[model samples]
Target chain A: MKFVIQRNQLIASVQDVMKAISNRTAIPILTGMKIEVKNHGITLTGSNSDISIESYIPAEEDGIVNVEQIEEGSIVLQAKYFPDIVRKLPEQTVEFEVDENLKVTIRSGKAEFNLNGQDAEEYPHLPKLQTDDSFEMPIDILKSLIKQTVFAVSTMETRPILTGVNVKLNQDKLSFTATDSHRLASREITVKADGINDLNVVIPGKSLNELNKILDDTEETVEISVTNNQILFRTKHLIFLSRILDGNYPETSRLIPEQSKTTIHVNTKELLNTIDRASLLAKEEHNNVVRLTTLENNIVEISSNSPEVGKVTEEITVQSFEGEELKISFSSKYMLDALKAMEVDEVNIDFTGAMRPFIIRPENDDSILQLILPVRTY
Target chain B: MKFVIQRNQLIASVQDVMKAISNRTAIPILTGMKIEVKNHGITLTGSNSDISIESYIPAEEDGIVNVEQIEEGSIVLQAKYFPDIVRKLPEQTVEFEVDENLKVTIRSGKAEFNLNGQDAEEYPHLPKLQTDDSFEMPIDILKSLIKQTVFAVSTMETRPILTGVNVKLNQDKLSFTATDSHRLASREITVKADGINDLNVVIPGKSLNELNKILDDTEETVEISVTNNQILFRTKHLIFLSRILDGNYPETSRLIPEQSKTTIHVNTKELLNTIDRASLLAKEEHNNVVRLTTLENNIVEISSNSPEVGKVTEEITVQSFEGEELKISFSSKYMLDALKAMEVDEVNIDFTGAMRPFIIRPENDDSILQLILPVRTY
Candidate 1:
């Protein structure tokens, strides 16, 4: 492969693919990134077993990229060295040339480097998924959906399927659900995909995390494609593919309740701060549990007691209250997560007895809901 | 002890003293902060065996502080809990009271906390040092002096003395030296003092690091008092005490030479980048060594070769040359450090010989100097 590319453009593309390359790969060849130069542009691919990323740089981008030679060829260079070399290049433009024996040469200004290259044929190829099922959505909405529910996924790998977030779509609505048995987060959004059938897939939470880091917070649309086992998300010049878990996701519909014995409306910030204070003491306990009690006269008392560490009690005034007064004990972290996911200023928390799970949602919006199972503090 | 103080003021004092308190202290009382309430104001102190910090909050500070009680007493509370509790308090003014039994009550607005407090008498007392030798200097200059030389201290504790920075005062000049034997960094600054006496002390690098974090970048003068075995630094309302290491500092003055055979002047930034790029390939080698060779046409060549990895070569333009052309190889990290510490745009390097040690300093200034021993590359 022989070509010349801009410093910034190459750095951006290399950074995207570097996310998929792991330093601890058992297979030595898996650590290298495949580079291909054609008439159109240059394509870089990097993959582990779980996720794969492919980035492209056009031959001409707003007069930024200029390819001097049209030599169509491919080679695999060490991903670890390529990015560092490009980032620290002393010149504005970097030149690349490959000899007959596949020895790659990179030069910028007066600095020159020669790295032994491996045949690109030795690198594993990503399974090409048929674009039979594809959809497009705004990048902002997708990022928000992932942020709200991905954190609640089970980090323990005992049940491999539970480590992923389950996505369900029906024509016009998309639902995302994540639960670790103790706490659950669910969000739904409406998209403009016509003539698409029902879709269900389980994507690993770790893959979404990597995707989030490279994604810029812009209003551009991202095209998503899925096959039987592999799913692909394509943006302006980047493609992200993740392997899907093949298993039946648990039925989470029966977990959320329809009614509650008591409900309280409180300012989201006020309740969040009170719980944060109580957590300082409760964090020393085994479950980090804090108790919440609804008192008369529009007052709510939050208390956490650790026999070893002292006790903390706080009183916050709620905006309004109705129904029977109740007392509940749950993990302080769960409460904090539920409060943070809500976007509205005021939140309404519905309690169904002491032991039953409770639901929290924004006072004005019903699309985002969070549920937490109370801990047995007896 | 009973008192009410502004939250921000108390938080500031608590953070300042918390730096001295260690979580893994051998003595239980050492894990707590001593709080004393006097008729004039409140004082907080935290101490480990190596260092102690004390901060005072007066009864009234420009009408920002208010004291309600004249009670005078002292108690010690767990340093880990008190800081978090004070930071998360719900009111602007927090009320604190300790009974004769050492039980503490902290109340602010509708929140209350009851914590176990130990008698102040159980806390370790700081050593009293006689202030016979003292001097004062600008805090900014002192901070800069510490930052420029502390990073070169030997991290390995085999030679305990080398783990500290040696500061020696002679006549009107103060010199700081640090080394791990492989590389050494030293700088001298001029200061005015009334007494005519020479002094030398080795201060632990870890303590200096913590002090750096707490010292603000201000032009105010700080009074420094050196005793037989301890040093104390006093600012407006803060007192910092550190135990000095015992033993004599090695004679590094004899290591620097007064003559040279070759000298090269180059832009500090240009040479820094060249070494940085060379290190990328040299990193694969065990020593991360790079070679620099001066040519006849005011040109410098930087190169690194790793048998298993690859090789890289770069050239940097030099402004002027003197004496004979020379080539030397050394750790890239040492050269990078020397360049970073330089304040002037251009630097002059003196080469005693091809195998002998070399010196680097600002072209226009003589206050700072760096020396590096060449590595024999076969």
Candidate 2:
């Protein structure tokens, strides 16, 4: 096999596939990246036990030749060295040649590398997903949905099913929910579902995180398919597949409070800054609890104290306040994360009571909700 | 004590002094930063066993009122949290007050912090350095000198003296040298040392590393004084003091050869890149050996091999080559470091023989020299 490809384009594709490659994989062949060249384009695949990523570079596009002198063949090169070599290649174009013995030779300008190549047959086959539960959405919307809900997923392995974002679609509205049994984040978006309505899958949060990075924030639409065992996200030239958690995701609808004893509309930026400052001392405590107390005239005071360290208090005048006088304590980290994810200038925080879970929502927008369980700091 | 200061100015000074404060320090007081408020300005000090840094902020500078409501007093606050607090303060101006019980209160906008402050009396006093062996040089020049030589210092404690850069001033030239037995880096700059002649001291590489970070890159002259036990670098608003490592530096004058058997002048960038690409496979070898073989027509070949991984070979054309046919192997890491330190577009590499130490110097310049020992491969 022989081929010459543009170095810059090859580097980008290599990096994308490299995201799914891991050095700690139990299967030795999984540590290598499989390269397959055809008359049309070149495909690079990298995979671990849980996730697989494949990126392609077309031979010719828009009157520009990205690859030439292609001979159809396949081989697997050590992922550890291939990415670095491609990045550091000297010239704009690089040439690759494979001998009958599976020896790989890569040449660019005056540099030449002879690497030991593993047979492509040893790599685990990545079967293409076939299902009718496929849907299309703008790439940016998918990225935002992942960002809003993925952070709240359980990081511990005790509840392995909770380590994924539960994606569900019902009656023209699609929602993503994640919870570690402590705090829960749920986001809903209105999608025009013509034939696909009953789609539910739990994609590993770690997989979504990697997928978010690989997916560009573009207006172009991406196709997503879900099967019983796996979910696939496909773009024009790339495909990302991940194994889904087997257990059923818990029903989280009852965790969010529908009624509030007290509610206040506050400047999101001001409150975020206040919580961040107060958390400096709160971080010493294992729970990182920061107190919020409502005062007269729409003013809310946020404070935290560690006897060994010190105390911090900040007062922010909310835009509006109603219901009853209230005081609540919650993890400052959870609050900060939720506030950042709100992505709005102003938000309404509703508190059912001092001991009950509270929900924060973007003003006039019911599509996104962040619920936090308050600490009993009596 | 009470003072209101511009937040930006305080933040910069706080960062500078914070470099000296380490939480892992054995002395508990060293973990806190001492703030001394006087009628003129405020002084912030942080110290560890190896280095002490003091940064000052004046009450008014160049028609700008940086500090107001100043009441002279002193107190120590935990350095771990103070920097973060100052950085995240809401308003441009921050005010501080201390009660008789040493409880400190910091306020900015509507945010207030009450921190536990230690008595200033318990803080260790830094004695001002008094020495006639003092010289002044541009801060940028000093920064360059440090960067060029400090990386060669030995990290192991086997030879304690090798961990510090040997600084010597003879007549009109100031030189800095560092070596870890296998490789050496030396840089010299012409200074107007009239009153001072024999200023020789060994400053710890770790201390110089910290000092390099605290010192800004500017043409402003910084006053430097050297005592047997300490070296001081003083700028207008900052004073950096580092304890000198106690030992006699090894005689390295014999390490550099006066004559060369063969010398080659090559493009510094091209050679550096070629070596870097070849080192990808070389790194797996404990010695990281990459061979340089001189070929016909001013071409040099660089190659490295790890039998289990693969091999890489790259050839670079030098501008001029006047050398006997030489094939020498050396650590790619050491060679890369030396080449990077050369800081010149063209360099002349002088090799006495394959076994003898070779020196690399900037073309047409004698101020900087890098020498590396070749590993025996045969």
* TM-score of the A-chain for all models: 0.95, 0.98
Question: Native contacts recovered, in order, as a fraction for each?
Answer: 0.80, 0.95
Candidate 2 lDDT over residue span B231-342, tens digit each? 9999989999999989799999998999988899999999999999999987765478999999999889999988878899999998888858898999989999999988
* TM-score list, all predictions: 0.96, 0.99
Candidate 1: regions farther than 4 A off = A62-70, B62-70
Q: Model 2: how far is B238 from its true place, Å?
A: 1.1
Model 1: how far residue B174 lies from native, Å: 1.5
- Per-residue lDDT tens digits of candidate 1, residues B1-378? 898888888898899999999999899889999998998888899999888999988887677555656489999998888899999998998989888878888899888887888889988788776665777778888888888888888999888999889988888798888887777888899988655368789988878887877778542987777887888888877888998889888888788878999999999999999899889978855477999998768999999987656788988889888998888898899889878877679999999887888989988677898888889896
Top candidate by TM-score: 2
- True A-B contacts kept by model 1: 0.80
- Poorest 10 consecutive residues by lDDT, candidate 1 chain B: B61-70
Two-chain complex of model 1, DockQ on C-alpha atoms against the true structure: 0.67
